[model samples]
Target: MNSEGDLVHGRWLDAVGRDGVQQAVGLLDALSEAHTIRRLELPVHTMLPVVLRQLLLPVMIDALGLPRTRQEWGERFHRGRFSEDERDRLAHYLGPRYGDRFRLFDPQRPFAQVAGLEALNGETKTAAQLVPSVASGNNVPLFSALSEADELLLMPGEAALWLLHVHCWDTASIKTGAVGDPQAKNGKTTGNPTGPLGQLGVVVPTGETLYETLLLNTPIWADGLEPQDRPQWAWDERPAGLGCMPAAQPVWSERSATGLLDLLTFQARRIRLIACETEQGTRVHRAIVSAGDRLAQTPETEPHTAWQHTAKPKKGQPHRRPRRHTSGRAAWQGLGTLLAMTLPVESDGPYTSLLLRQIADLQRGGVLSGRYRLGVETSGLEYGTQSAVVENAIGDDLPLPLRALLAQDDGLREVLLECVDQADQVARALDGLNNDLRRAAGGDPLPRDKGSRPSARFLHGLDATMRRLLAGLRTVDEDDEELLERAQLAWEQCVQMAADREAESLLAAAPPRAVVGRTVKSGDKEFVYRSGKAVGVFRTRLASILTRVAEERSAKGEEAAAA
Candidate 1:
């Protein structure tokens, strides 16, 4: 970081003895970017965001100062750059000792680690604890083949990548509890909350380059930003335990972020890296993980997450919290929640992350081009019981046309949203079709979740088609009846094919008894439960669900005639 606290990305971490690509792996967020919506990927971890927000963004905002009016924030964003004055302020903060300060092996001051932190534990913890994915200690891997007894060997690069992962998504488990922490019970700590990103479906705005991505993610401060505490690495003196020499671990406390710096690198835990020389290379064989800072009352300020109103809020409790990512659920399935306009329309609504709002502001100001396509990437870890087990790691992306994204009340947004609703309806219809098929075969219908396999398959099969449909929005100027009709036809055909395929597969797998069919008599009425009977009923429902789009169009036409 420069003297003014701006994160100097280039050559900043070269002191770590890695090349650009190697450094990028350690620094950049886990999900990588490409030219277009070519592919989707998982995030390795989150590190750059912490450094940029803590050391750079706060100072940069203050240099730019507060906005004169409501319109100014968007205006500056439209311009999309730092001013000459802002650049000068950053230049003034540079110093010569940055090289030595960034050293990982610095005897007095190491980067993102306390020098003598190993003394607190008096014994080294397993190396596996640094990486969230590693199955060790109490991380009982129900889904993994490796047992907890198997040890892990980490290279310097691997160690660096997962080190950041632990800080951001560390699970709640037994901790050292440190000497000063009041929450420590019997010299051991439990009930420590997971890292800030633990429950959040992390949302990040992607651009062509790092500069563009960083600027796009930065939300202009309403009242000029003020520089508070610098990032821990840039501090004048290193204090291990919240400023006490003897106490080298933070007390178990939760409070609001003091400033951008405090919140970004919130330090969910205090860590010390034990690097040693080995034949292979510098290996991080052992380390210590202890409780650090905790995130409390922060749904509004955290820019990287979506927020939803709790369905059942207690009388005196807050109603909103960071939205969670569903395991095995596609991003396109919940497109409505990612949009900003959906919040005001419903009582228990989910508003989008703050970054999405910033993008909309830029579009409204007429600074952004409609030709540009936006890639909204979402990533998060799904923790199991007590937030200890890493059940699922979710990462997905949606490439939305700028014109469609900026429209809420009318235009392309309505067309896209309407199509999504129809797709969902079709999926549910498929689920019912499968249940009926089973019932006709003389077997009781399965549960909604189990019977919905076909529905899930049908929806997942359309993922590529949906992406193409969204990308195709560029062909239309705005809301066009013909365009929406054409899109609806495409969706209907996809749903029809998927349902028929699943139905045939089920029938082919049936036994001889089921093929013969069954009948039941209830009073005077006789009912048939057979493949033929189920097929007839399914066709009727499918036809009705598919034709609703046309029916709605016809009704709207009649309403226009009445007017």
Candidate 2:
């Protein structure tokens, strides 16, 4: 292991008690065992591997209107419109060893019944029955039943979804660790194939990373494969085939793509329960199979991709270079304006625009074309053009009531409200700084204790508070001079107070002599002590914010003063 990994492992070892350490080791062993079993299931020669191919084969077989019997499949393979190579491949796949693997086409294992939307009305099977179980105990039954060519498929409309969820999660887990780290060696940062943390029903609660992983796995239609190529009727014509709906495509259309994401997001919120028979009685417990379904539902749960915004890419799209947009901010601003017209009072507008803009920029940078590159800050002018527009518009100083009324009509009300709230929060945070430091020091300040000592809690709280305040200022409305002045003052005071506190804390925490490093223990948690760098890093952020705030104050102040 690398130094970083060793350090992290050591920390984990120390943090996880004796029992926890055993459990952690056992989990890793189980995961490794599962991976080994999965590898043996891979098919000999195909672009799509065994499990993925198997998952989609039943639907493909039914869609192609192939016969259930191996004899008929061989006859069709010889007679149908297939290339010589395709014919040979089909023949080999249908041969004794691999033939039974095609569950829908295997005549021996007949389905109990056909199920679809119509069947949903009368179907009584629980979600747990339809989807594969994540519980180790249930794996044996799931593998046995699902592996059978004739076993029941719950809902054809939903089967594609579950297949996608299962396949992508498996792929992601194999590449990354259990948590699905995007920065992991083989992990994909962009695209619809996120690591499988959700498939195992583990929520990391670390920003939107896990949710992004799920969206990354959404099965999109290949550019080479169009909807017209394989018409819906092709699948519908087959008799005894359960599902009538075509497989869900992420790039079908804007409406279709959005709808799929919405449905996936909804399913992500549903929890599935597995029933186990014990000696005492029947026991029902939660399983990871439904983990993706039970994702925490929220507006942010939906995944965003550049492909969703533009038409489906043509074949060879990933190999081509994308054209750049120098004045691309206008495109994003136009989208923002349209959204603002129908904006919700509580909804995030600018941030939404920001994400959209970021994706658009990524698209322009050939991100869709598979051109990997680093991104530098796009919005990096001493003062932004948007702020200038707001300043030019802020001509007259109106009454407080009139200002409030106008603010209601202003398209940027949501952004402005957030700014006001942040300023208020930071101001209040500054007022309570001493108490926070005291709390970190066990709720009692020593007589010789200086207010400058930085504790983990105090540093983290200040860091968070300052970031919020700065985010609000990013899109601060210069039109409202009164509000602008108050916000500027708050920004200045916030930076100054934070710097003073950090300096005092650093000096107070200093030992008699400087050493290479030291460790401090608080309760059971151990913290590595670095010499005053925390305070220094905190100051850098404050300095950056203050610089921007000062520029706005100077330019907008003179304009407002003249008005």
Candidate 3:
């Protein structure tokens, strides 16, 4: 802060670690320009920890100054001009509000811990209990290397990080009922979400820089707090308030987030850190964790998620809820739900996440240029049976050009999605071909269709071509029919070449038995499963699926011209 006490500044790519500005800046810089971050050598999962993102709205509000109306919001970014004072405020919120520390056991106000849990003599749980990676309660460490870490002792700094992680993502088993919490029945709370972020398939919009990234995620146009559904509540920071978010008392309750400020900084758990003296210094040895305030993340208030809409819902009025990410699915494979103006009937009628839709709005409104490529980052956890285990964490970044996501270009979008559909259909046919050849050889079908490695490989092969077409769509002007033709033709050619290579590999790997063929009962009818016959069948299916998509696109274009 300067002499006037009104300034702060930090970028996502900062080289040095500055206190209160942003943590992990140097680490992020080291891993800069990475197109994907799937597995870390460590056990931690998820992209940005909740603790870092919690201060997002406050910084955006203070420094970036959101325009009240949605239209103005788009225009403001389009004309990225600001006064010096505005820049100062931006600097202020980019980090902590002057003087706030990230310490876990701060004497004045400990980081994220409820004010009086220490005085209340809250029952303490192991420091490991605060870690999501550790197998606490009855959660058996079936897989993840994250499950077997040093759980015995935690330095206060490391303990604070885990403390926040527990509050944000602790599992659903059972929680210790702090002595003062009235909501705890028999000194326990159960069945709450593993954590708020755990429940949400978080969708983040990224740009070349952090400025564009944060603004894209912030939906200035929508009102998150609707009185009818979710009502807003206040948060008190007074030490006497004994609540996770510092209320009159700690209570497990549900409420609506007033805006971005509260939504990001949601008090998901009541946590207290126990500090003990170690030979080195103060180390956190134990903790108390209880259920805290509950805030539902939806397309309306929470922008970073996909939603599924129901028109004639069975119970309440027609509504939408956050859509979960499917494991083993690529972001581009299900791209329609993220960019299409029209929702696929099969996936329900919800629009894309409010963030994406808003981005589309900005694109069409000239807030973003046609060629400005943006990275769409989607992160979600695939949980095991009964939501007890984390099967896998999914993170995929898809680069999409602004022109490809324009809201008004619905016709072009329909064709682009159809192109995606064409590839999907053919890939599945290849999977069938894999099994048919195996069956012909008198071999039992491969588990999970393992024989269809070709199909998976084929899809991976198409990804580069798909990204090119998506980016190349920027060249298609309303009057330039030639550019559009070339783009479509390019994709068709790429798919054919890629499919042929995959088919060649599959056929070459076949044994003599598969070549000779055998008759097998497929469904109800008896069918010959010769390698030659299986290849022909799949090729025929692929041709038909692609032909059908091409014809549909032409027919739609004709219909559009006629209209």
Clashes of each: 5, 16, 3
TM-score of 2: 0.27
lDDT of 2 by residue, 422-498 (tens): 43343334324433333343344334334432333344444554444434443444365666567656756664566
Q: What is the lDDT ranking, best to worst?
A: 1, 3, 2
Candidate 3, residues 1-563: lDDT per residue as tens digits?
11111112212222222122333231222123111222122235363434335543444453444566666676555544334565555445333443243334555555566655632344566676766556655555565344434445775435645665665566666677766777777767766766777777777777654445555666664443322211011344222222223532456576545445556666677777777775766666677777777764442666777777775567754467777777767778877777745565555564677778777777777677666767787777766656656567787777765655765455566567778887888787877887887898898666883444666898988988887777667455644556666666667767877887888887888899898988878788997778988988887787677674457567889999999
Question: Residue 546 lDDT in model 3?
Answer: 66
lDDT values for all models: 0.61, 0.29, 0.60
Q: What is the lDDT of residue 318 in candidate 3?
A: 41
How far residue 399's Cα lies from its native spot in candidate 3, in Å, is: 0.9
In terms of lDDT, the poorest run of 10 residues in model 1 is 28-37
User: Which candidate has the top score in lDDT?
Assistant: 1
RMSD of each: 6.5, 23.4, 7.6
| lDDT, model 3 | 0.60
Comparing 1 and 3 on lDDT, the stronger one: 1
Model 2: residues with Cα > 4 Å off, grouped in runs: 1-171, 174-459, 463-478, 514-563
lDDT of 1 at 312: 68
- Among all windows of 10 consecutive residues in model 2, the one with the lowest summed lDDT is 390-399
Candidate 2 deviation (Cα RMSD): 23.4
